[model samples]
Target: MRKHAGEVGRYIVNGLVATAVHYSVLMANLELLDFQSAGVANFVAALFGIMVSYFGSRYFVFKNTVESIISQASKFGILYGLIAILHGFVLFVWADWYAFSYSTGFLIATVLQVSLSYLGNKFLVFKK
Candidate 1:
């Protein structure tokens, strides 16, 4: 019980760091580059976030793994790739179909993605 709690705590902290990177890149693309395409901005941000998340999840969140770095990264990439697709779908529906702002869509998508990511990382990617 205690071990699971510690893992969950670490996952939350590392997830926050990765999410910050994701949002920063997204906002930079939107505000600095004047990018109007939410899909493009989200993709770029997710790429950066995935990189950060891979390291953080591997070393900080699930440190008991025995998989090689390549194996772990491949699994992580697959998981995030699926999650990114889901994020894109949610963003499209919320921002385009429902007439929400990009930021709002991003926030909603982040919640969905984070929930899915925690499960994938714990059971699929880093399973003992």
Candidate 2:
């Protein structure tokens, strides 16, 4: 029980770090770079976050894993690829169709994607 609790805590921390990276890049791309399309900004941000998430999940969140880095990263790529697509769709709907701010859409999409990512990492990518 305690082990699982620790793992959960670490996983959440990793997620927070990755989410921060995601949001930062997203805002920078939109505001600083003046990206016209929310989807494009989101994709760029998600790509950066995916790289961070791969390393964080491998070394910090699932430290006991026996899988090789290549194997784990491949799985992470597959999982995050799908999540990224979902994120872009949600962001488009919320920001473009519903007239919400990009920041608001990002927050909502982050919550959804992070939940799915935790499950994917725990069960599929880093299974014990």
Candidate 3:
């Protein structure tokens, strides 16, 4: 339990950094780059976030350096890919169907992603 608490702390730190990267890419694509579609932009940003997430979780959160990088990366990719799809879907529904602010959709999707990511990383991707 104590060790897991430490891991949770590390995970939150890594998650904050990764979320910064994600939102930066998202805002850049939406505001600076002038991406026509928020959903597409979000998808691209999420890909970047996924990369940051994998590296951060591997080295900082879980601290599992003994495992094969290839094996871990493959599993990480799969898990995050599913997450990205769901993230995009939620945003798509909000922006496209309801014509709501993409920002709100982004928040909702982010909350879901954060929850799923911690659980998935702990139980599946970085499981011992």
Candidate 4:
């Protein structure tokens, strides 16, 4: 129970960091590069997010005593990269095609992705 609570808390904090990274990347692309396409922005933001989440999750969230940070991070990256791709797809499809607000689409996708990420990270990435 305690461990689960800690994991949840860590996930939330790490998510905030990832969100910051995402937003920063998006803003940079739009403001500096004039890339106004939401899909392209989403992809770039996801890459930044993955970088932040990899280190944050490995050291701060999961704290796995693994062989090397690179190995553990790569495994973690693979897991969340799958989730991020799904998130990007959903964001693009619903936001662009259905005319849903980007915020709304992102909210729905984050809820789904976060649930999957929690289980996968707890059981697979940092498992004993």
Candidate 1 overall Cα lDDT vs. reference?
0.89
Q: Give the Cα error of residue 11 in candidate 2, in Å.
A: 1.0
Query: Mind sharing the TM-score for model 2?
Result: 0.95
Ranking by lDDT: 3, 2, 1, 4
Q: How high is the CA lDDT of each candidate model?
A: 0.89, 0.90, 0.91, 0.80
RMSD of each: 1.2, 1.0, 1.0, 1.9
**How far off is model 3, as Cα RMSD?**
1.0
Where in model 4 is the C-alpha error above 4 Å?
Answer: none
Candidate 4 matches the true fold with a TM-score of: 0.85
Q: What's the CA error at residue 39 for candidate 3, in Å?
A: 0.7
- Our tally of clashes for model 3 stands at 0
Error of 2 at 90 (Å): 0.3
Give the higher-lDDT candidate: 1 or 4.
1
Please provide, for model 3 over 32-111, each residue's C-alpha lDDT reduced to its tens digit, 9 standing for 90 to 100: 99998888989999999999989999999999877899999999999999999999999989987888999999999999
Cα lDDT of model 1 by residue, 5-90, tens digit: 99999998998999999989988988999877777778888999999999999889999458899999998999999999888788
Model 4 clashing residue pairs (backbone)? none
Candidate 2, superposed: residue stretches over 4 Å from native: none
What does the lDDT come to for candidate 3?
0.91
Cα shift from native, residue 92, model 1 (Å) = 2.6
